[model samples]
Target: MSLTLAARTQHMTSSAIREILKLTERPGVLSLAGGLPSPDSFPLDALAQASERVWRTQGAQAMQYANSEGLMPLRDWIARRVSLPHWQVEPEQVLVTTGSQQGLDLLGKVLLDPGSEVLVEQPTYLGALQAFSAYEPAYRPWLADAQGPDPQALQPRNAMNESVRAAYLVPSFQNPTGHAIDADRRAAIAAALRAHRVTLIEDNPYGELWYDAPPPAPIAASAPHQTVYLGSLSKVLAPGLRIGYVVTPPDEAPGALALRARLLQAKQASDLHTPGFNQRLVLQLLADGFDLDAHVVSVRQRYKAQRDAMAQALTRHLPEGCIWQIPQGGMFFWVQGPDGFDAAASLPDAVEQGVAYVPGSAFYVDATLASRQQMRLSFVTLSVAQIHDAVVRLAEHLRREGRRSC
Candidate 1:
């Protein structure tokens, strides 16, 4: 018998990065495609010890089902850690999710409706687009530049046109583009959101991965009442643990109570709760003085060197007129090839030459705005030597393709 599918299935699409990763798995292919954190950065020893302690000390309880809102201690830790001088987060507002990806899904479930207008950057995180698309919201491109999204777009066209349900941003070391919004621009964006009375979803998974310096205080700090903040330990701690949290608006904020309730209900429906053993393992690590801050510092230093290597290689090997910037932090570099280049079309040849990267067009919500010449190259996963080699292969592919274009 034939089976019927839900209408939402039409909006769902496979992740371009995940699909590319499968091809990059071929023998001898050096990937600059996936934004995978280096395995070397994981605190293996500390995690092993933490896992043992959880199994030894709290074996039964850790294995059982847990609170849907997350363990209180972990939530408390998140609340204190994310709290700023001007704005403080409360434990009640923190909802620990299986991963920040789950937080995105939960928010989309509660906040979006069919045809709801949602503002997204021209080239935002593809994963966010994937998560939110399931809820079937109409996407409007939030025009941006090197600085960040334009504040003027936040303004409503007329008083009656306040139909924009929410705006999503990755203010610190944004995925795909590696663009970080400066402090002044963040404040301006916050002001616009406040004035327009629009809700903001601020996803900040790479805030602590900064190489030069920590990114500016979160945009949520400036407009706490109008923003839903999502943070994750995957980048800083361990992704396998799948630990992440969402900070909802304060009680006094409009619709705060109802929004939080729906989010909690959505969480319950999704997975009942994140793994209790993982939560306990994190607490055990902290209690044992794992020194996460120090670990993150070391991670930053190692990634910075890798970033430098990628920068040097790109400069030396890429064709003239190809453009990219030295990112201050994060895993990937967004590079635009010279005129007459098509990054997506060149991927098969690049992979055949033993290198791979993600075409930047996958990140755009609107096909017309997507650039055919751009690709995202990840630097954190490969060693310095491998990075240089990968760039050489990629540059050779570009040159060979350019000869054909001429």
Candidate 2:
């Protein structure tokens, strides 16, 4: 007799970044491979103070099981934070998820059928793809330009073949490619979404980490009725907290109301709501005047310096044929190696030279020859001096491989 497993398990693969990270642990290797925020940015002392208050005053409720919708005060704060002058989010519409990653999984669970077509950016967030894969939805590549995915793709030319159930995108400082969707494009996409039958899943984890200015209002802001918005505290706050939320479309609409119930149900089935003590810890911090806006300002300033160091290092070190986009706001610099240079093929040699970066091929659903030429470098986790040194080492390795101009 033999045991069998679900067929969907075949689509699940180990994370490419985690596989590369193991190489960084070796002696003297510099990693620009992880999109981790500097630990220096966290307000540990303030958090300690908040934790003390939570334990002393609210320990019972904080440790007790909570409602699936989450703590009321936390939900109220999230609703107010996400609301704009034109659009208002109700507290009941906010579903506290373990992490934004869990929100993606819940959306996949509730909205996707085995064969449903879901539109996604050409090289989208790999985590979202992974979360959606377990449910077995068909992946369709989103056609995009410099600004973002073309608004025209929001509606298929002949959707009669199969309706596109939803489109997923990272509109602000997207992973693997640091391109942010501009205001004009957001409006165009919003207008297109208004005409289309598809729902929009807007996942924005890096919106608050902007270097120059805040990104345009979320695409959901333009068409709140049609978009299910997701946001996270990992970038601005500590990622270890694992706090994130989902803002469902207005409850007044019949479809949105139904979706909200299913989402809450999925969330309850997932973890019975995010850890109550953790939620209380964050609430205590906020109530104690944590000044989240000012905290983000400091984080932006620190990451900006690191971003500058990476930009300068790349210009001074990388071969003439190599190209990279200097991200204005996010943690990554998406670099394209010289013509015919395969980033994955060169990773072993680069690690041997004491440097590492994530190969870009894993980020694409429809990877091609062009995709193999790219890689993503994370500047946030390393110091400015380390970033410059890593770029120099990576360049030396590229030269040795005969992929760089002398």
For each candidate in the order shown, give its overall lDDT on alpha carbons: 0.94, 0.89
Model 2 agreement with the true structure over 237-285: per-residue lDDT tens digits: 9999999999999876549989998998888888887999999999999
By lDDT, the best candidate is: 1
Q: List the residue pairs that clash in candidate 2.
A: none
* Displacement of the residue 283 alpha carbon in candidate 1, Å: 0.4
How many clashing residue pairs, candidate 2? 0
Give, for candidate 2, the lowest lDDT window spanning 10 residues: 154-163
Worst 10 residues of 1 by lDDT: 155-164
How much is 364 displaced in model 2, in angstroms? Answer: 0.4
Query: Cα RMSD for candidate 2?
Result: 1.6
